[model samples]
Target: MSMPEPKTAWRLLKSAGVKYVRFVIVDIFGRPRVDILPIDEAKDAFIDGVLFDGSSIPAYGGVNRSDFVAMPDLDSVYIETWNGGKTALIFTSVMDGSRPSLRDPRNVLKSALETVKARGYKPLLGVELEFFLVKGDPPMYADGGVYFDGHLLHTWPVLEEIMEHFHLSGIGSTKTHHEVAPGQYEVNIPAGDPLEVADKVLAFKILAKSVAQRHGYTATFMPKPFWGINGSGAHVHLSLWRDGENLFASVKEPREELKYAVAGILQNAIANSVFVAPTVNSYKRLVPHHEAPTRIVWGLGNRSAMVRVPYYGGRINRLEYRHPDPSMNPYVAFASIVFSAYMGVEKRLEPPPPVDTVAYELEGVRETPRHLGDAVKYAQESALLPEEFVKPYLALKEEEWLSYLKSEGDWEKTWNKITRWEYNAYLVNV
Candidate 1:
């Protein structure tokens, strides 16, 4: 069930003793803006929605027609994990009059999932988010631990608190541990329906940051927060199901449906890179020889390939897309992936054979687009991404790239330095 009616939802909250509600909406840049509501007004806010000036939100709208409303997706209502149940939080999808707003990230995903369900299938997703804990202006690592470090005494308490909040928020964690890089960490959450999974991903980021600050360190999801060290990435594990059976897995060979989905993703990989790695710094994490994928190829357990079919067979089998970073808007990112898979299923396309060797060194392999400009160009010209979505997205990305060009920072001063913009923009906010 998506959710109960607004009155029922508000009544449930009232029964739980929630005094305040925060209606959240994520913008194209992956920033969450909230509208606070008292318990008395929440029911009306849900039924009629809350008005906001869309022009004030970056890339949302212009002055000519900037008014928009945020109607809470009641299915997404949950107690604020960090706020002790006194407050509840719900996500919103922008609406223009009675129609879904094309500019809203949640609406984009919702529309795509509706199409997938109509085709008699559901998209299941398991997300792995990697981030770092640091402090200071330039930032010093919070811990010197390495991958699976057994002695992360300093980091454990923070992670424990973060995980506790996640559990309270109803976001189940399958695994959590330190990553290979200093102060880096990873969290694995159980798979679910596409929209719910995306919402959880967003919530996880928010809670992770909130809990980290409570400890005295800043948590960053910036794709490449530091130079000469491993960068963070949010790898998405994708699969499709129908009537509780995984369509991507078969008793014998990989299913034909799985093959088609891979083909669709590869077909649109370049164009959709903007959705996966949306920020300028994301390209810094895509360098070859790193764990990140830079080429458009699939493999079995190969970290260097764009997509990898893990060794797990049967119901657990799925495709892991390696390019996306936690910096992306999960709603839009998942929508693009599933919609691209739809194109593959519709065409019955076959993907190129999976390569077993190191794909980064493999000759004739197509590189995933290198820079934001190339990605923006490919996305604008893509036939798969509808004009309504691609148009505003491209405009926003273009402005981001141009802004970076005019920006003069420490990176420009040093021949090889990471941009300070990423540090200032994401270190505290993300």
Candidate 2:
């Protein structure tokens, strides 16, 4: 479905009985922040914005330059699904007076989408989001169900509610299923324009957790919620379009455009690792034998390859980026991939031979960063992340890594099934 025309947004809200409008925006760390305004004052969003003190937000800005504007994107307006549709939800891009903030994650995605548009193409994105539905407010119990089991019978009520909510929120999901790990589930949100897909990803997480709460369960999207289990990943499926043709689809072999895009993604995988795997716990999920891709390689229908081209043809053909997890900011992560592909198209970069063997078992295959510190060091040396973002992002990630190092003992984290510290830090908070 297309975004509603800006002039009709207010009318639609009123027709839907929206008593309030929630202006939403994500921070550098991908945390959702909001400011609620009465429906009567909603028109002010289109004029300027609802002002807020940005300095108080984590790692956003300081008091000296904290004054900021959150200009709502009317095209993104939707009725709140988890809240009985009583609230109108609209996403915002941070504004420093009249200009978009360079640090805003959503604006970064918009900039990348513009580059694709300039090339006479549009990016289409679909995301597979995975999370755990553990018991307890602090999440001490893992639902006693295995992969693809009849856990559907146990959790179908909540899953059904989630599906209904996704549809009502205008972010329709393609599928929902019991995942590999116990208490883990995967919800596949339908494909859309790059910017909208990112927005929907943020929205889905918020609404999913809220719904889980109402169902007496806490949904956690932490990359590795428990030790020695399958971790959650936000595996992205992407393809480019021009007018009506799928650029990734080829009659034989693969198209030049597809080749160049794959080349760009693989070439920058290590440098862009920090954005793909943003947290300390993210690395815990990236280790070998965990069903997560750790090497920089691509192959047709290969789950072990970092980039997998499914064995399908025609318009449905696309690349599945398997490296990213749910912990990173979807906006930054998706835009970074687009920018890398942009470089590939412009430079006509070539991809290496597709690895037919398991990439992790291959003797000399290149690996993604093994730790947060390693990812930061590699990002520091690369230009994939815009110059404005590197300094602040590096500071934040490095601080997280240091805190992890000082807090956890290697033996306990590996053998004791300890989650008290991790749960307190990330559960329900991130």
Candidate 3:
């Protein structure tokens, strides 16, 4: 079922044992924020929206200054994990009085989805997010179990509780499995409406990690916790449907539209990477092998390709893009996806000749940009994406990168000091 409308959603929250509502929003740096309120304040928040200093949030300051509103998306109201009986969390939409805040990442995505509906297509967007389970206060890699190593593994035995929590919170994930690393695992939700998919991601991250901690361990969504092994992926699965028919599929032997969309994404790959794999740590995961697509190539069933139109279901099926890690703000990620796909629709774009041959060995195809600095530059230079996303997004990230750069030690030395994944996986290669 589609989530309830806001008014009814508000009614349900009032009726529940819900005492305090936390207005949850993600800063431009992908960190979630909360503005807590007592039950008495809920009605005012539900109707008028709560105000805060816009200049304080990363990537949010205006030329002079502006006060922003945090309007609760009431349907997003749910019991926050790890909270005592008094607290509940609700995802928020950024706004200014009656006007929705254009600088808000969530609102930016909502605007993009409006375009999707206007274009007359129902977009099916899904994600498979992977992360690692650890035991330290700071969280460290724990196991060496290859993918699907059952419950016999370490303190990572809380899948049932995690699944149940997701179900009760109204964001049900479709699948959970042990991943290739010892403590790593993945949870997947089936594709549906684009906005809902983004909501599920927001709810899942805060809650899932909270649940993991409840079992006396921490879960890190940091891409690539261990080196040399498979790094984590938020591999995005995309497809199009019009009045109950998949639109990206090929009818006979090949399709032109799929080719166009693939080309468009490749053409925008550098800009897209800034949003998809946002963190400096994220680049460590987007390496040459272990299913990371560092090169801009496409092929059938090849995990290494950035775009894969796998030949699983027959003519004119969906294609999966093997980029995007778990750290992205889902709102921004899905919004850019629809925008890229929209370009495909606009230009009748198509993927390059199916590299039926292996993509790793493919000669002329371009390679994905090398680092976060490179990705940031690409985002600045691209005229294809909405200019709104470009400037604010980069400003947000540059601020974050500057902060991360200020650690006690130097970049060359402390780079791996914070992460052992490179040493564990690619030390020899380096």
- Per TM-score, the best of the predicted structures is 1
Candidate 1: the clashing residue pairs are: none
Would you give me the overall lDDT of model 2? 0.81
Give lDDT tens digits, candidate 2, residues 370-419.
77888989999984655666678788888877777677755335432535
RMSD of each: 2.1, 2.4, 4.2
Q: Using alpha carbons, what is the TM-score of model 3?
A: 0.88
Q: What total of clashing residue pairs does each candidate reach?
A: 0, 0, 12
- Which of the two candidates, 1 or 2, achieves a greater lDDT against the reference? 1
**lDDT, candidates in the order shown:** 0.83, 0.81, 0.71
Ranking by TM-score: 1, 2, 3
lDDT, candidate 3, 1-430, per-residue tens = 5667656666676677677887887676456778888877766777767778877786666647767778777656667544544567788888766777666778877888788778787778888888777776445566666677765445545677777777766676577888877777889866877777777776777776777777876667777666667777888888877788777777545466567777777777877888888876777677665778877877777677898776765555777888888877777777787778768876887666666655666676787766666778787877344566568878766765565555433445544334543333221110
TM-score of each: 0.95, 0.93, 0.88
